[model samples]
Target: MKNYFYFLFFFLIPFGCDNTKGNKLVEKSTNDSSSIYLDKAQKKNIKQSEKLKYYKKSFSILKNQTNDSITRSKLFELTKELYKNNFSEDFLESANLLTTLSTKAKDSFYLAQIHRSKGNYYKNLPNYDSSFIHYTEAEKILKKIKNNDGLSLVLINRSLIQFDTGDYTGADKALNSAYLISKKNNEIASLYAISVMMGLTSMETKDFDKAIKYFNNGLEIIKNNNNLLGEFNKETCLNNIGLSYQKKEDYKKSIDFFKTALKNKSIKSEDPELYSLLIDNLGYSYLKTGNLDEALKLFLESLKIREELKYYNLIVLSKVHLSEYYRQIKDTSNAKKEITEALFIAKKKKTHRDYIAALKQASIIDVQNASTYSKEYIRLSDSIRNVEILSQEKFARIQLETDEIIKEKDILEDKNRSLLYTFIGVVFLLSMLFVVRAQRARTKELMFKQAQQRANEEIYNLLMAQQDVIDQSREIEKKKIARDLHDGILSRMFGARLNLDSINHLDDPESVKKRLEYLNELKEIEQDIREISHDLSREKQDLINNFVSITTNLFEEQTATHSAKLTYFMDSSIKWDLVKNNIKINVFRILQEGLQNINKYAKANTITVNFRKENNELHISIEDDGIGFDVSKKSKGIGMQNMISRAIDCNGKLDINSSKENGTKITLNIPLE
Candidate 1:
C-alpha cells in the first residue's frame, strides 16, 4: 500500500508540463504542423487583443449565417481551439452556438462532438461526474456512428482524468483502447501521448522495464519531429527514463538523463517550473550518488525558483529536499525549520505526497517525534491507497455499465433483424399483433395509474409535512404569547390596579400625582395588550402574503441545513386580498421545491430568495451560488417537473437560467388582478 501511494505521487511527475500545457494551446487545425498532441495551440504568441479581434470577426461572420453548415463548423472549430487555449471569455458563447446548431441540424455526429467538447470542458473544471456523463453520451453516439476517431479521442480524454483520480486500471484500459486505434491508424502523434500514459500506469504497478519500453516507444515517435510537442515529448521521455532509473536505484543513468532533459530548449523557455522540478529530481539523483555539495546547490536553486514562482506544491517538494540536505550536513536547527515548514504546508494544503515526504524525513532527523510522524505517515498512506482503490473500482463499474448498455443495444438490433426477416409470416398475424398492442397499452395504462398514485401520495405527504411544520410554529407562537401576557402585561396591570385603589385613600398633591401616574400605567398596559394582540395576529395569520411567509420559512430551513448563507425579503405592502389562494399555494410549493433542489445539489456558498410585485404580477426569484447546469441541456428531474406543474397550475411562467460556474436562478411570475 505504501509503495502504491508513492506510485500515485510520482504518477504525473513523469508526464512533464501537466496543466501548464493548457496555457500554451495555439490555434491549429488537424493538420497543424506541431508534433505535440495533435494541433497544440500556441497561447503565448497570441495576445488577448488578437484573440478578441479574431473572435469578433468569427462571431460576426457566424452570427449572420448560423444555419450555414460551413460557417457553423468553422466557428465551432475555431472557438473550440480558442477555449482550449485558455481564451475563456468566448467559451459560453461557443457552447451556446454549438448546442443550438447541433439541435437544429439534428446530426448525431455534431451532437456527439458537442458532448465530447462538454466532457473536455468539464474535465478542465475538475468536475469528474459531469465529465463522465458527457463522455458516456459521446460514447453512445460514437457507437451509433462507428466513429473510431471519436471513440479514441474520448478514451484518451477520459483516461487522463481517470489517471488523475487514481484509477490506474481504468486509465490503462482506456489507453489500451487508444493504443489499438493508434496501431490500426498509424497515428504517431496520438500514439506518442497514449504510450506516455501507458508507461505511467505501468510504473504504478512497479513494472519498471515495461514502463521503459512504453516511454522509449513514445520517444521514437517524436524524437526526430520538429514540432513543439515533439520537442516537449523528447524532454518528457528523458525525464521519465531518469525517474525510472532513480526508482530502480540506478542513480548514475538517472542523473545523466535528468541533465539531458534540463538542456532541452522547450523546458527552458516554455516551462521554467518543469525545469526547476528536473533540477530538484536531479538533486535527488546526485544525493543518492553521494554528491553532497551538488545536491545541496541544486536543492537551493530549485527552492529559489519555486519561491519566486510561488508554486506551492513544488515549494513543499523543494523544502523537503532542503531539509534532507540539512540533516545530512548535521544542521539540526535548519533541518527542523525546513521540514516543519514543509509539514505545515502539507497539512494546510492537504497534500498527501508532501505530507508523506515530510513525515518520513522528520522520523529520520527528529528521533523524539519520530514515532508520531511515522504513525501519521502510515495513516495517510492507508487513506491515499484506499482512495485509489475506490477510484479504480468506480472506474471499473463505469466500464461494466457501459459495456452492458452496448450489449443491450446489440441485442435489440439483432431482434429487429429477426422481425424484418419474419415480416411476411407476421403479415397474416395482424389480428394477433393488434391484440398484443392492446394488451401492452392496457399494461402501460395500469403502470401510468400506479405512477400517478405514487406521485399523488408523495405530494400529499409533502403537504402534510409542511402543515406539521406550520402547526409546530403556531404552537410555539401560542406559548410565547401566553408567556408574554402572563409575565409582562398581567403583572403591570395588577400593579396598576393596586395603585389605583391606594390613590383613592389620599387627598394631598403628592397622592393626586401618584393617582395620575397609576392612570398612565393603566393606559400603558392597555397599549401593551393591543401590541401583543397585533403580534399574535402577525405570527398566526399571513399578513401580506402566505407565499412570502412559506417561502421565508423554507429558505430559513435550507440555510440552517446547509452551509450556504441566505438573504430573503418579501414586499410587505402587497395586498393579500387580491392574491388567490390557489396561486399562493402553487407559488409556495414551487418555491419550496426549488429551494429543496438547491439544498441537495447546489454546493453553493450563498443564496437569495426574493419576492415582489411588479406590474400587477407576483414575481418570486430563487438564486444560488451552487454549480448549475445548462438549463437547456440538463434533463428535467421530477423535482423540476413538479415545480413546472405547480407553475402551470397557477397560470404562471417558470424561467430557469443556469450554467456551471455562474450558478442557477429560477424566476416565477404569476398574474394578480
Candidate 2:
C-alpha cells in the first residue's frame, strides 16, 4: 500500500499599526468603531458570524472615511484580513475584491500579494486549476521584483497544490526551489513553512527518517522566531514529528513528542483547534503505547474542546479516534455511539476522511454494517483516485494561462488594435485547447477501459496456467511417493520374504538356526513397516511436501530463469503447517510477480529474498541491486498490480521502497494468525 500524506497550511500576514500621518486618522476611525470587539479573544470565543459583524461594521466605517486610493487600498487590505479571519467561508468574494483594489492602486507588490491570497483561497476550496493560476501570477511578479520571501511563499504554496494533484516529483522540485530561496534570504518564517511542507512530501512517499529530519529542522526554526504564529507552528511541527515517529513504529518517541507539544502555552490556552489536535495526537500515542486510561482521558478532553468550539470538522476527527479507543476495550455500545456520530457528521459535511474512518471501524465492530460501509468506502476511494490522477496537467495548463493573461494585460492595456488581435488569438487558442483536452480525457477513459479488458483476459490466462502448475506439483509428489515405496520399503519386504521361504526348506538341525535367522529377518521387516507408516502419516508435516517446499520450488525456477544472482534465506522457526494453504499460495504468487517485475524493469545483477517470523507476523522481503525508479509514479504493469492485490488478499501490508540508490526493496508482512 502507498502512504498518502495530506497537509493543511496556515498562511499569516503580519498586521500592526502603521503610525504614518494619514494612517493615524484611518486607524483611529477604524479602531474607534467596533474593531476592539474583534480582538483575538472575541475572535476565538464568539461565533464566526458575530466576529464578521464587528469586522463588517469596522469596514463600513473605514470605507466612508477614505476615498484616497492609498487609504482605500489599505482599507481593502484590512477588509480582506477581516474576511480571512471571520468570513473565509466566502473566500472568492474577498479575493475578487482584493484583486480589483490592487489593480486600481497600480502596485505590483499589492498585486502579487492579492494573487497569492487568491491562490490560497482556491487551494482552501481545493480547486487546483484556479489555485495554480493565482500562484503562478504571484510567482511572476515576485520573481520580477526579486522578492525572495514572496517567491518562497508562492513556490511552497504551488508545491502543495502539486502534491494534492499527485504530481509528487513536481511537488518535490518546487519545494527544493523554495527551500533554496528561503535559506538564501534567511527568512525564518518561510523556512519554517517550507521545511514542514518538505517533511509532509517526504512523509507522503513514506520516507520517515527524512520526514523526521525536516520536521525537526522546521521546529528548530520555529524556536528562532518565538511569536504567536511561530508558537502555533511549533506545536504543529512537533505533532508532525510525532507522526513520523509513529509511522516508524516508535510509539514511545511519538508519545514523548505529543506530550511535549501539549506543554506549549499558546496551543493549550489560545488555539483551541491546535490544543484539541495535540490532545487527540497524545491520545493516539497513549493508545498505541497501551496506556488505555490516559488515552481515553485525552480523547474525551479533545472531544470536549472540539464540541465547545463547535468545530464540527474536528469533532468528527476526535470521535473517530474515540470510536477506535472504545472498540479496543470491547465497549461496543460506546464504540457504536462514537462511530455513529462520526458517520453522521461525515455525511452531513461530505468529509471523506471522517467517512473512511467510520467505515473502517464499522468493519470491526458492526458486522452487519461492514459490507455496506466497505462498498461505499471503495466507491469513494475510486472517485478520489480519478480526481487525483486527472487534476495536475489540467491545472498546469491553467497556470500557464494565468501567466500569459497577466503579461498580455500589462501590454494590452496601452494598445487598441494589438489588443483586439491578441484577444482573438487567445480565444481561438483557448477553444482549441479545450477541444484537445476533452479529446485527451476521452482517449484516457478509452485506454483505461481497454486496460481493464486486458486485465480480465490475463486473469483468465493465469487461472488456466494455475491448473497446470497445480497438476504438475501433484504429479511430482505422487512420483516421489511411488519411488520411495518401490526402491526402499517394498524391496526390503521382498528380500525378507525370500529369506523366510529359504528357512522352511532347511533340515531339522539347520532348520532351528535358520528359523532364528528368519525371525530376525521378520523383525527387520516389521521395523521397516513402522518406518513406512510414519513416513505416510499426515500428523507430522513433511517439509519436502509442504507449502514452503512448493514456494521454494518457485524460487528455484526464478533463479534458474534469470541472470540475476539470486539468494534466498529463511528462518528455521516458521511452522509452515500453521499457515493457511490459500495464504501460502498468495505469498508464492506475490513473490513470482515481484520477480517478474524485477526481470522486466529492474536492471540489476543481484537479488536477495529474505523471510522471517517476528511477533505474530510473517515478513517476506525482496531486494534488488538495480537502477530503481520513482515509486511515487503509479505502476504501469499488470503484474505489479496483481502482486498488490495478492498481498492485500493475504491479509498483508506491502511496502515497495525504491529510489535511485541501493535499488528497490519490496516487503510484505502477513499476520500469522
Candidate 3:
C-alpha cells in the first residue's frame, strides 16, 4: 500500500517544465533522421494544443516504423502521456494504433506497457476493481519479459486501489514488494515514497510509534533529495503524527505538529484535499484542548471548503466537529441541530466514523438525551470495529495463502536443484528407496490415523443430526400439548359452562341460588379457557414457523391483554431452507422470552416486527416502540442468551440496537446455502 501511494505521489506531480505554459522543450534525437522528423512533427502538433492531430501524425509515422520495437514503444508512451493529460479520445486512438503496431512487431514489452497505461487511466477514475484487472493483465506480460521495474510499479498502483477500498493488508504487501524492488534498483525517491505509505498504514492501524518511525525515515530521505513534493508528503506525515497523538490524548504535542503541518506552503499549493484534511485535524486538536471558539472557527472554514468541493466525507467530519463544539459550549439547541445534520450527512455518505463521531458528540448534551445518543454511538462503533476486524482477518488469510504458494515454489526449486546434481542422483534414489521402505513399515500407523479422523467426523455428523431430530421432536411436542389444552380441556370447560347455565334456568329458589353460584364459577372458568386457548393457538403455532412471528404475536397478545398497541410486519419471502429446526426453535424461544421481558419491564407501548431478505440472506428484525433498556450496562437475560445461541446454531448474525427512548431493533441474518 505504501509503495502504491508513493507511485501515485510521484506520478501525479507534473514532471519536467509546465507544458501548459508553452515552454519550448528539447526532444531527444536519435541517429535515425526519419524518427527525428516524426518527433518534430509530433512536438509541433502538441505545442499547437492539437493532441488528436499529434497522435494521428505519430501513429502514421509509427505504422511505417513498426519494424523497430523502440519506435513502437515510444508511440505507446506518447499515447499513455496523452491519456494522462485527459485527451482520452485521442489517447484511445493512439493506444489502438500502438496495440496493432506492437502485435505486428511482436513486442510484448510495448503491449504490457499499453495495458499498464490503461490500468492507470482506470485507476485515476477510481475504478479500483477494473484497474486491478488491467494491472494483473499487464503483470502477466511484464513477468514473462522479466521487466521487474514495470511489474513493481503496476503492483504498487494495484495496491493503492486496494488501500482505497479498505484492503490495508493487501496494500501493505504490495508496498513491501515494491520497496524490495526499489531497494534493489537503488531508486531513492521511490524508496522514500514507500516509507511514507508504510507510515500512513501504521497510522491507520493506530500504531503511532511505528508510524512515526516510518515518517521520520521518509522525511530524512526527502531532506537528502531536496524534493519539494516529498516535503508536501512530509506535511501529511506530520498531520498523521498529530492525529496519532490526539488519539492518545497527548494534546500538546498533537497541536504542535498540527501547527507545523499547517505551515507547509508546498502542501497548501499542491493538494487542496490534504490542506482541508490538515485544517480538520487542527480543529479536532483545538476541540480536544477545550478551545471551542477556535475549533468552531476552523471547523466552519473547513466545512465551507468541503461543501464547495462536494467532498462528502470531509463535510461530515467538519459537521461532526462543529456539533462537538456546540455541545461543549452547552448550546443544547444548536448542538442538537448540528448533530442531527451531521448524522444525516454521515448516513448519506455512508461513513461509519462520521456517524459514530456525531453520535458521540450528541450523547454529551444532556443526561436524558445522552443515554439515547450514547447507545447509538456504541452500536455504530461496534459495527465499524467489526468491519475493520473482518478486513484484517481477510488480509491475514490472503497472506497465509501467499506464503503457502511461496513455500511450495521453494520446495519445487529444491527438488529441481537436487535433480541437477547427476553424481548425487544415484545416492538420492537409494535414500528415497530406504525412506519408502520405512514409510511402508508405518503404513499400519497411518491407517489408524485415518480411521481416527473418520471416526471423529462421523461423531460430529451424528451429533448434529441428533440435535436436529431433538429440535423437531420438541416442536412437535409443543404443538401436541397446545392442541390438547385448546381442544380437550377447553371443550370440557365449555360443556361444564353449558350445564351450569341450564341449572341456573331452573325455578326452585334455594336450588336457584346454588345454581347461580355455580354459574358464576363457570363464567370464571370460561374466561380462563378463552385466555389459555388463545395462547395455545396462534402464538404456539407461530413459534413453530417463524421466529419473528412468534415474538410479534406474543407482543400483540400482551398488548391486547394489557391494552397496548403493538404493530409488526413479517416478510413472507424469507428463506428457511438453510436454517436448521434447532435454530428455529431457539429463535422462537428467544422471542418468547424477549416479549415476556418487555411485558415485565418495559412500561411503554407499540412493538414492531420487520423481516426482509437481502443479498441472498434472510433478516429477521424485531423492534418495539417501548421503553428500551441499556444493553451495555445491563447483563443479558437467559432469554437474550437463548437468542444469541440460536443465531450461532444457524451460523447466523444478530444485532440488538436499543436505548432509553429509541426502541430495540433485533436483526438476525441467516445465510442460505
For TM-score, the strongest prediction is 1
User: Could you tally the backbone clashes for each prediction?
Assistant: 5, 0, 1
Clashing pairs in 3: 1-171
lDDT, model 3: 0.66
Worst 10 residues of 2 by lDDT: 15-24
lDDT of 1: 0.71
The alpha-carbon root-mean-square deviation between model 3 and the true structure, to one decimal in Å, is: 21.2
Ranking by lDDT: 2, 1, 3
Candidate 2: regions farther than 4 A off: 1-11, 14-110, 124-128, 163-168, 227-229, 400-673
Candidate 3 lDDT over 372-463, as tens digits, reads 56766776566556545554554344334543533465564454355447424543564476468547746766678557745754664576
Residue 437 of model 3: what lDDT? 58
Model 2 TM-score on a 0 to 1 scale: 0.49
* Local error of candidate 2 at residue 198 (angstroms): 1.5
How many clashes in candidate 1?
A: 5
Q: Candidate 1 has what TM-score?
A: 0.50
Error of 3 at 539 (Å): 78
